[model samples]
Target: MTTATLPARSDLGRPIILLMAVACGVIVANLYYAQTLIDVIGPQIGMSASVAGLITTLTQLGYGLGLFLIVPVADLFENRRIVLGSILVTVIGCLAIAASQGPTSFLVASILTGVGATGAQVLVPLASHLAAPEKQGRVVGTVMSGLLFGIMLARPVANFLAGSFGWRSTFLVSAAAMALIGIALLLACPQRRPRGGMRYGEALASTFAQLRQHRVVRMRAFYQSLMFAAFNLFWTAAPLALIRQFHLGHAGVGAFALAGAGGALVAPVAGWLADRRLTRPTSLAGLAGLSVGFLLADWTVAAGSLIGFTIMAVLIDAAVQLSQITGQKLIFSIDPDARGRINAAYMTVMFVVGALGSVIGSATYEAGGWSASAIAGAAIGGVATLGFLLFDRGASAPR
Candidate 1:
């Protein structure tokens, strides 16, 4: 898909961007709605603490697989059709989860939910494809703000809904909301078909080829993997810490998670920075902030300061979002034709590592408590920070 053959670069006005952002948020929320309900859902379903972590791990694992399997097809299919189909699958998964009678059924539905949630991934590259070259960063950032907000707010919203109704009811409600969003998207979003005549198998193969071909793709993936690991580590374990160490109930957990939603505000700023060609500095600051956030989380827990803990959560989330947007801005600029595959490779690595992080977080929290989880997060963040400082200086941003 050369520039000449590309779809007309239509204006991405505020309404379209807002619709895309909200749609992305609703779709991506499926992956995280289970996180805040782990404690409640685990016991009701007869899962052990260690095994309960799989609730999140499986969702992320399935999403990672979809990134490699489904997302690449965006380069070969009509974008709106793929997105609408994925939403229908998500509705089935959500309904299945609501009706599940045991852990086995619940886990299977969770995987499907994750796979279907790749619709959000589809929209992102679609948004990039629609925007003009000069405005891609801002457009991506705006859409990402919605995605990040969904992630940040899903926990609180799930916690609140589960508290009011039941854990199962949350899934049922999500299914209904997704159906509505699907209808809106179908009517509003324009059809975008890639110009290339590549087969599905070749499209998938070229994703790997891009990985082998681009140093920036590999480095950005590596860096983002570490940052995302720390991100998952903190979120997967923090609720447990709040419940166990801080002696908070579901309401308190929901409130704490709500405070962290403030971090999503950083998405636009990160995008603006990227638009100005400040990705390198933004990346470094993001890494450092992640490292400091973890350390501060440890201190807050020790001091028994709920306010401090909330602030730390905001800092950590901001850092992760900032790094992610910067990485995305870099990758998306590399090959317009391969944005789907590039994102697939980048997110596949990031989430695979993130799945591991969730497991480690659950294990460490069970064994050594909040301090262990915090230290583990800090260590991962430190590695990302060091890697960026030492290696990223030689890398050049795409013009």
Candidate 2:
């Protein structure tokens, strides 16, 4: 369990960072690989299409639970241990899902996979811990770009793999990946015992305490929550719109999703800007960009321009990453000693609120169409903009 102690310079300059980044991407991908496969995985496992949504829902819910419970443990334990242990759990979950022949078993495996995938969150704060203050934003940004890649690639990759092999093949591949990533991390990661003296109960209690104690945490969570809501909304509804309006099949939707991956290219740039202390203006631009992207998509969808919609997808995704990177850099700097707990609070609330976007996106698209979903997403962005302008900078802002 003991890792070799390396000097900070070589450690930070070395391959551990890349390992963590790739580890994060692969681990988080476990949460999503089954999302697109659920439709096919369902009937074989005796789950009806109507009830199949729970597969994705339970995974997300399990992720939420991990964000609330497991991520905070990073502050109190050796992070490498937490990271490796999480990988082990996810590998188990993936194997279980691959082998499951019943709906109950598959759903349980999905939840376990979701929970274990939160190792990505721990690795995120660990990136900051590993980097010097001046380099924290850059390091976090690089790693986050990997996380974004996982999110962007999971659906399309799942579809292609499931098509070629089978739905179970995706989970089997994920299990094998975790086994490899876990070994790499086990070898490469350094031992960083956290400085926390808090007990388990106090550490858990402090997650909420940190949110109430820090204005930056509250506002950052608020802004990111809205941005994430807009993100999930556009993504959830856009594919349905493509199918309903343009007659594009799953492959076309996958390609459209792939096109949005280009947006993750901004994550590093945003982080660099944050390192320059440009968070305020960068955040303003992100909010405005999101609103504009949604509006453009609205017009494009009405005009039946698939290319225009794709362009908006890239823009919307870029704006979301910009906002995310900016907020994350700021908040990670907020509480050095409690990065894990604060991050848990930040992400937990953000995702809880963000999940509503999917709900709203589905409802709006089914009820009123893509325009309504876009408008609703735009409204969420506009609200975040107003909050940033009106409240976030209200006299005592850190940035």
Q: TM-score of each candidate?
A: 0.92, 0.96
lDDT (10s digit) by residue, model 1, range 188-221? 7877877667888999999878889988888888
Model 1: how far residue 78 lies from native, Å = 1.5
**Which TM-score value belongs to model 1?**
0.92
Q: In model 2, how large is the Cα lDDT of residue 306?
A: 96
Evaluated with TM-score, which candidate comes out highest? 2
Distance from true position, residue 272, model 1, in Å? 0.5
Candidate 1 wrong stretches, greater than 4 Å: 1-10, 38-54, 102-104, 366-368, 396-398
C-alpha lDDT (0 to 100) for residue 59 of candidate 1: 87
